[model samples]
Every structure is written in C-alpha cells, then in structure tokens.
Target chain A: MKLLEDRIRRDGRILGTEVLKVDSFLNHQIDPELMAAIGKEFARLFADKKIDKILTVESSGIAPAVFTGLSLHVPVVFARKNKSLTLPDDVWTADVYSFTKEITNHIMIDHRFLVAGESILLIDDFLANGQAIEGLLSITQQAEAEVVGVGIVIEKTFQKGRQLLDGLGVEVESLARITSFDEGKVSFLS
Target chain B: MKLLEDRIRRDGRILGTEVLKVDSFLNHQIDPELMAAIGKEFARLFADKKIDKILTVESSGIAPAVFTGLSLHVPVVFARKNKSLTLPDDVWTADVYSFTKEITNHIMIDHRFLVAGESILLIDDFLANGQAIEGLLSITQQAEAEVVGVGIVIEKTFQKGRQLLDGLGVEVESLARITSFDEGKVSFLS
Candidate 1:
C-alpha cells in the first residue's frame, strides 16, 4: 500500500481540487509489477473469504480486477457498459449514473456467468461517488450471489463513498484512501 | 498454443462464420489462469523483440496485456475509447470503425505514455478485420514509437486479418488461428 501511496504522491496529477489522475502508473499506463502487488494485497486482506468470481465494470476496473483474479485464482466477470453483439440476451442489468461523465449507463453481466450462491469479490480502479460499486452490487444481488468484499486501488474518502457502501454493510479494502484535497494538495486517510 | 486451441474447442462459441465468442473465458468472464498462460505464450513468441512497453486497448485487452507486462517486466498502456475529464489534453488519437458494432469511435493514448523511439508490443483479445490493431498501429506511429510485434489471442485467418496486418509489414503472433467456422464448428490453424 505504501508503494501505491508513494507513487500517487510522486506521479499523480491533481486537477480542480477534485480529480486525481494517476493514469501514468495506475489506469491508462499501468505498471504490471505494481498492479500485481496491489492485487496480492487484496487477496491477503480478503484471505478469510471464499471468492468464486471477481466482478468489475468495463475499462478502468479491468486491470486491477485481472490482477486480483490472478492472485485469487478466480475468474473475473466484467460488466459491459453497453449491449454488445457478442453478449447473450439473458443478463443481469443495473443502471449506474456516473457523476464524473454526467451520464447514466447500463452495466450488465450475462446470467450464466454470475451463478446463484457464488461468492463475489468486487474490484475497481477508483471509488468516487460509489455508483459503479452499487451497480455491481445490484447485479450480484439479482443473481442471488454473496458479495465477499470490495478491493479498491484508490478511494476519495471526502466523497463519502465509504459511508455509502458501508451503509449497505459491504466491506471495502482500498489500497490508498484520499482523506482530503485542499489548494491542490492531497491528503491520505492512512 | 495447444492449451488455447483446446480451450476454444471446449468453451468458445461460434456465432455464424464471423464471430467466435470466448466471453465465458477470454473476454467477458475471464479465466486468469488461462489468461496468464496466454500472456506467457505471447512473451515467449515475442521474446526476440525488445519491448519497452505493452500497448493495448481498454477492457478486453487489459487482462492479457497485464499478464504480458508481468512476463516481459514492462509497463502496460491501454488506449481509452473516449476521453474522460481526467485524461490530459495532449494525446495521440485514431478513428476506428467497428464492423461488429457498426460505429466509429476514437481511441487515444496519452502523449507521455508512448514515447518516441520506444519499442512497443501490441496485445489484444481477438483479431477479425484488424481494425483495432490498425488503430493501435496508427497511434504508435503518431508517437513515433516502433512496434516490435503484435500478440493476438485468436485470429480468424478466413477473414484475412493477418494478411491485412502482414501487408503493413507488422509482425503478428496469434496463439490460435481460426481457419474456418462452418456449420457451427470452428477449425483452428494451429
């Protein structure tokens, strides 16, 4: 976790006192070694739970989810943003509103992928308003599956995404929790 | 490669002659163990090339790219479909036509990630008409980066995607080459 926090401080770009761009090493341009370490830490934190599948949204979440899948030795099911020609007709769907993009999109997972009674671990790159995680949780609940926990690469604690998810009684393990942002300076909860 | 061909035969769904759906394992629902093996195989195939970074598109390619990056000990950079608020204004962009989706979208990579003269290895989940690869190649060229080679999980030889890329003088290494798909049966060129 120290590695991630240090890297964020050194390489992260703060824009408009709200957005922290760690694209150089975390999302857009990824350091697989560092990504793998974060995944291993997630596996370690959730060592007590039995995870059958790792669920995530498309795009950004795929890397961390894939790495977590690698360490956990479980399959990863990424919920697609749109209905693709390849995806099946029978699917579990949830509507999520992205405050950043100022748009609402449907995220779906094929019914066959999320089997009933399966233990799911949700993973993503960042948590802002918790819309993405809520959408994923909705899909998991529809399948009658149990959510083991969540593993986030970064968290904006000031956004209170933690409280939003915690209210649902979902356990979250974020590698780096951003406590505040003042005058372009970022602070960590850890 | 045998492992990949075997997986295709077992789990890959053939939709008509144009699409081979491996969503259950390769894309939508990912098998990390199998994904890891594919990455290792890609690293083996491109071992001769000196790759400084692994470049791929977002979503599907992230899993294998992550694995390939792990094996090659290089950073992974995924080109995003749309520009978000977080991405910097300075980026290299390309327009791609998705025959499957019947839509044209732009894929872009940060100018800082793909440096000039850096050797890059392009990785992806599937190659049909080589549109995605071509888009990536265009971005790489804009960055003045050298493309070492391309690592494809599956290539539909019948569609002649390989020929398209090969015509451009780009080296392509596909784990499982599909020769034909007739009567709902898939044939591999392994």
Candidate 2:
C-alpha cells in the first residue's frame, strides 16, 4: 500500500476537485511490476479468505485482477460492459451507472463461469462512486455466489462509494485511499 | 506452447465450424497460472527484439499483455475501444472491424505512452482476422513507433489473419496455431 500511495503521489494527476487520473501507470498505461506487487499485497491482505475466483469488470480491472488471481492461484472472470439496455440471455447481468461517463452500462458475466456457492473476491482499479463494484455484487448475488471481500487499487475515501460499501458490511481494502484533492494535489487518507 | 495446445484440446469448445470458444481459460474465465506461462512463452519468443513497451487492445488483451510486460520488464499500454466515431484529441487512433461481432471500433492510445522510434511488441489474445493488431499497428505508425514483433496466444491458421500479417511483413509468433476445426475437434498446425 505504501508503494501504491507513493506512486499515486508521484504520478497521479488531479483533475478539478475529485478526479484522479493515473493513466500513466495504473489504468491506460500499466506498470506490470507494480501490478505484480499489488497482487502480492492483495494476496497477503486476503490470505485468510476462501476465494474460489476473482471477479472484476472488463478493461481496467482485468490487469490487477489477473495478477491477483496469479498470486492467489485462482481463476478470474471479468464482467463485460454492454452499453445497451437489452440484456443478453444466459448471463448474470447488472446495470452500472458511471458518474464520470454519465452513462449506464449493463455489465454481464456468462452464467457458465460463476456457480452457486462459489466464493468471489471483487477487484477493480478505482472505487469512486462504487457503481462498478455494486454491479458486480448484484451479479454475484444473482448467481448465488458468496463474496469474501473487495480489493480496490485506488479508493476515493471522500466519495460516497466507501460509505455505501461500508453500509453493506462488505470488507473493503484499497491500496491507495485518497482523502481529498487539495490545491490540485492528492491528499491520502492516513 | 504445448501446454497451451493441450489446454485448448481439452477445454476449448468448438462451435459449429470455425468458432472455438476458449472462455474457460484465455478470454472470459481466465486462468492466471496459464496466463503467467503464456507471458513467459511470449517473453522467450520475443527475447531477441528490443522491445521498449508491450501494446494490446483492452479487456481480454490486458491479462496476457501485463504478464508479458512483467516478464519483459516493460510497460504495457492497452488501446481503448470506443464505439462512437467521434475521435478524441491528443491520442493516436485507428479503426478496426471485427468480423465476428460485425462492428467497427475506433481504438485509441494516449500519445503520452507511445513515442517516436520506440520499439514495441504487440500482444493479443487471438489472431483471427488481424483487425485488432492492424489497428494497433496503425496507431503505432501514427506515433512513429516501430513494431518489433507480434505475440498471439491463439492463431487460427485458416483465417485471413495469419496471411494478412504475413503480407505486412511483421514478425508474428503464435503459441497455439489451429489448422482446422475438423469434426468439432481442434487440429494443431504443428
């Protein structure tokens, strides 16, 4: 977590009051070495949980989730995002509204991947509004799977996302927790 | 490569004639261990090339590209797929047509990641119609970056993808090459 926080301080770009762009290393252009270390850290954090598989959304989440899956020795399933409201058959689906993009996407996972009673650990790049994680949790519930915990790469603590997850009583762990963006700079939650 | 071939032989599902669904390991439901092995294989295959970065499309390509980036000690940049034709500023973009999905996607890479004269290794999950790689190549060209080689997880030799890459004079290495899907069974190009 220190490494991640340090990297965020060094490379993260602050946009307006609440936006943090880590495209240089975390999301768009990825640092695989850092991802491997993050994977190890997540593995250590969730060492006690019985995780059958790791679940995440497509694109950004796949990198961290796969590395964590390697460290945890589990399979990873990424929920695909479909912009249309018309849901596909034979898949566990949930609608996620992204405040940044200002659009609602129907995220889905093929029913063949997740099974009943399977233990899943959700992973994502950033926990802003928690809409993405909420969608994953919805699909997990639909499949009758158990969520052991949620692992986030970067979390905005000032946002409503953390509070929402806390209300659900889900154990959430983020490598870097941002308290605020003061004077166009990142302020980590100590 | 043998490990991957064996995995496909055992787990890959054959649809009708030409389609091979490898959702269990390669794409949707990913096995990180296998992906690690794949990363190592790609590293070995491209060991001679002076690769400054690894490039691939988002979602499915991130897993293998990150693993390969870890092994190669380089950064991985995934091109984002934008459905809308409206191009964003300050990014290198290319249009790709997916034969399977029958849709055209404009893939974009941030200009900050790729630099002129930088050597890049293009990585992807599958090589069917080569449109994805073609798009990446186009973007690389736009950035004036040199593509050293291409690493593909699975290649359908019968498809036009292989021939297209061959025509472009790009060095391509596929871990598992499928000659045909005869009688709903996979046949390796060995």
Candidate 3:
C-alpha cells in the first residue's frame, strides 16, 4: 500500500481539483509489477474471507483484477460494458451511469459464470461516485453470490463512494485514498 | 497449446458459422490458472525475443496480457477504445473497424508508455480478420516500436488474418488455430 501511494504521488497527475490521471502507470499504461504488489496487498487484506472469484468492470479494472485473481488463486470475471454478439443471452445485468462519459450503460455478466453461493471479491481501479461498484454489487446480488469484500486501487475519499459502500455494509479496501485536492495539490486520507 | 485447444473444445461455443464464444473461460469469465498457462506458453514462444513490454487492446486482451507481463516480468500497456478524461493528449492512436460491432472506433496509447525501439509483443484474444492487429501494428509503427511478434489465443485460419500478417512479415503464434467452422462443426488446423 505504501508503495502504491508513493508511486501515485510520483507518477500521478492532478487535473484541476477533481480528476486524477494515473494513465502513466495504473489504467492505460499498466505497471504489472506494481499491480502484482497491489494484488498481494488485496490478498493480504482479504486473507480471512474465502474468495471464490474476483469480479470487475471492463477496460480499466481488468489488470488489477487479474493480478488479484492470480494472488488469490481464483478466477477473474469481468462485466462487459457493451452487449457484444459473443455475449450470452442469459446474463445478470445492471444499469450503471458513468459520470465521466455522462451516459448510462448496462454491465452484464453471463449467468453461467457467476454461480450461486460463491464468495466474490469485487475489484476496480478507481472509486469516484460508486456507480460502477453499485452495478457490480447488483450483478453479484442477482447471482445470489456473497460479496466478501471490495478491493480498490485508488479511491477518492472526498466523494460519496465510501459512504455508499459503508451504507451497504460492504467491507471496502483501498490501497490509496485521496482526502482532498486544493490548488492542484493532493492530500491523502490518513 | 494443447491445453488451450482442449479448453476451446470443452467450453467454447460455436455460434452459427461466424462466431465462437469462449466467454466461459477466456474473455468474460477468466480462469486465472488457465491464463497463467497461456502466459507461460506465450513466454515460451517468445522467450528468445527481447520483449520490452506487452501491448494489447482493451477489454478481452487485458487478461492474457497481464498474465504474459507477469511471466515475462515486464509492464503491460493497453490501448483504450475511447478517449476518456484521464487520457493524455500526447498519444499514438489509430482507428479500427470492428466487424462484429459494425462500427469504427479509435484506439489510443499514451506516447509515454511506448517508446521508440522498444520491443513489444501484441496480445489479443482472437485473431479473425486481422483488422485489430493491423490497427495495433499501425500504432506501434507510429511510436517507432519494434513489434517482436503477435500472440493470439485463437486464430481463425479460414479468415484472412493470418495471410494479412504473413503479408506484413510479422510472426504470429496462435495457441489454437481454427481451420473452418461450417455446418455447426469446428475444424482446427493441425
């Protein structure tokens, strides 16, 4: 976790006061070694829980989720944003609104992949307003799977995402939590 | 490679004559163990090459790319389908046409991640018509990166993908190569 925080501070760019661009290492251009470390950290954090599978949204979350799945020795299932021709018809889906994209999209998972009673750990790259996490939680609930915990690479604590997950009584683990961004200077939640 | 062929035969579904869905283990619901096997296989195939980084497109390719990066002890860089707020302006991009989606979308990678003369291995889930591979090749050319080879989980040999790559003199290693899919039967090139 300290490594991730340090990396974020060194490589992360603050866009104005709200957006944090970690494309240099986290999202677009991934640091696989760092991802492996974060994955180990998540595994350590959720060591008590029996995680049967790891679930995440497509595009950004796949790398860390795959790494986490590797550390946990579990399969990683990514929810697809678009309904592709290859996707199965029988799916568990949820409508998620992307604040950045400003559009609502359906994230779906094949019903066969998520079995009932399986313990799942949801992983994501960023947690801003919690819409993506909510969507993943909805899919997990629909599958009757138990969510052991949610692992996040970076979280904006000033946002309502943490409170929303807390309201749902979900155990959320974040490697880096941003407390505030003032005049382009970022502060972390101690 | 045999492991991958076995997986495809067991879990892969042949939809009509055009689509084969392996969402059970490859793309949608990923098997990390199997992915590790595939990654090891890729590493073995490209072991002689000096791979600086693993390059892939977003969504499906991320899983194997991550595993491959882990096996090779290198970073993985994925080209995003759409430009997001987090994406930097200094990027190498290309437009790709998805025959499945019947739409043309732009894929971009930050210039910071891909440097000139770096050896990159392009990883993808499927190699069908080679349009995606061509786009990636174009992006690599733009960045002046040397594409060591292309690694594909499955290749539809009946399609023009292989021929296109051959025309470009790019070496392609496909774990499972499908010769044809006709009359609900899938044939592999042995």
List-wise, what DockQ does each model earn?
0.87, 0.94, 0.77
Rank order (by DockQ, best first): 2, 1, 3
On a 0 to 100 scale, what is the lDDT of residue B63 in model 2? 91
Q: Pick the lDDT winner.
A: 2
Candidate ranking under TM-score, highest first, comes to 2, 1, 3
Please give the distance, in angstroms, between residue A25's alpha carbon in candidate 2 and its true position after superposition. 0.8
Model 2 stretches astray by more than 4 angstroms: none
TM-score, structure 2 vs. true: 0.99
lDDT of 3 by residue, A21-135 (tens): 9998888888878988888899999999998999999989988898788789998999989634355579998888888778877899888889899999999999999999999
lDDT, model 2, position B145: 96
Model 1 chain B lowest lDDT segment of ten:
B80-89
Cα displacement (angstroms), candidate 1, residue A5, comes to 0.7
Write model 3 residue lDDT over B1-190, tens digit each, in one string.
8888888888889987879999888888888788888988999999998999999998899888888888899889998896343555788888888998788778888888899999999999999998888999999999999998999999999888889888877678999999877877768888
* CA deviation > 4 Å runs, candidate 1: A83-89, B83-89
Scored by CA lDDT, what does every candidate get?
A: 0.88, 0.93, 0.88
By DockQ, the best candidate is 2
Winner of 1 and 2 under lDDT: 2
